[model samples]
Target: MAETLRNTLKAERERLDLTQAALAERVGVSRKTINTVENGVFVPSTILALKLATALDRPVEALFQLDDSGVSPKQDT
Candidate 1:
């Protein structure tokens, strides 16, 4: 089955005026990972997803979606 991970990371980060590096530091991940996530090249693990949502001050559901009608479907996570 396919899933759609819709993240407001870029939008939230920009709203907070934070760089990807800054977000990465807060989320305890490499900037490259954040870049991949923001670009939809990587789907974060559950823990990583929670960390990112926490850093962005949003709920996990706001950062990641599972339904098919939302963002484009991704290959498996």
Candidate 2:
């Protein structure tokens, strides 16, 4: 069985030098929402995931992925 959502959200945000509040603002969500999502306490809806991908200029799969190997993909940039 594949794992549930795996997130590189915090890493991706940091790569862009963005704070949680900053990312939240871009995605129209609260900082706490970003925090929870980062900490794996919450799974974002598809819309929010797409918003994040758009704001970060990445494919949603890069930030949120599912893999049976339990391995996170390496950053392309």
Candidate 3:
């Protein structure tokens, strides 16, 4: 499996008291896009990620991270 992009978009958005529609407007995307991202149904583009971080007043790394669940097990050499 490919590494998944984990995010704390929903928590950050709530921390800032912004609704999905509000955050989407700030990022120039549809609310559905934000919802999908929050639900891990979509991986946002780098630009989108930056926009979200900026709007949420957070670093991109704070909002997103790589999950280790997709890592393959090491094989014997």
Per model, state how many residue pairs clash. Answer: 0, 0, 0
TM-score of each: 0.80, 0.82, 0.87
Model 2, residue 38: C-alpha shift (Å)? 0.6
**Candidate 2 worst ten-residue window by lDDT:** 65-74
Name model 1 segments beyond 4 Å from true.
Answer: 70-77
Ranking by TM-score: 3, 2, 1
lDDT of each: 0.85, 0.92, 0.95
Best by lDDT: 3
| Residue 13 lDDT, candidate 3, scale 0-100 | 97
Badly placed stretches (over 4 Å) of model 2 are 1-3, 67-77
**Model 1: per-residue Cα lDDT at residue 52:** 84
- Candidate 2 per-residue lDDT over residues 1-70, each given as its tens digit: 5467779999999999999999999999999999999988898999999999999999999999864585
TM-score of 3: 0.87
- Candidate 3 lDDT over residue span 1-77, tens digit each: 66788999999999989999999999999999999999999999999999999999999999999897868788999
The better candidate by TM-score, 2 or 3, is: 3
Candidate 3, poorest ten consecutive residues by summed lDDT: 65-74
Instruction: Write the residue-wise lDDT of candidate 1 on 1-77 in tens digits.
Output: 56667677789889889999999999898999999998888989999999988888888888777556645657897
Residue 53 in model 1: shift from native, Å? 1.0
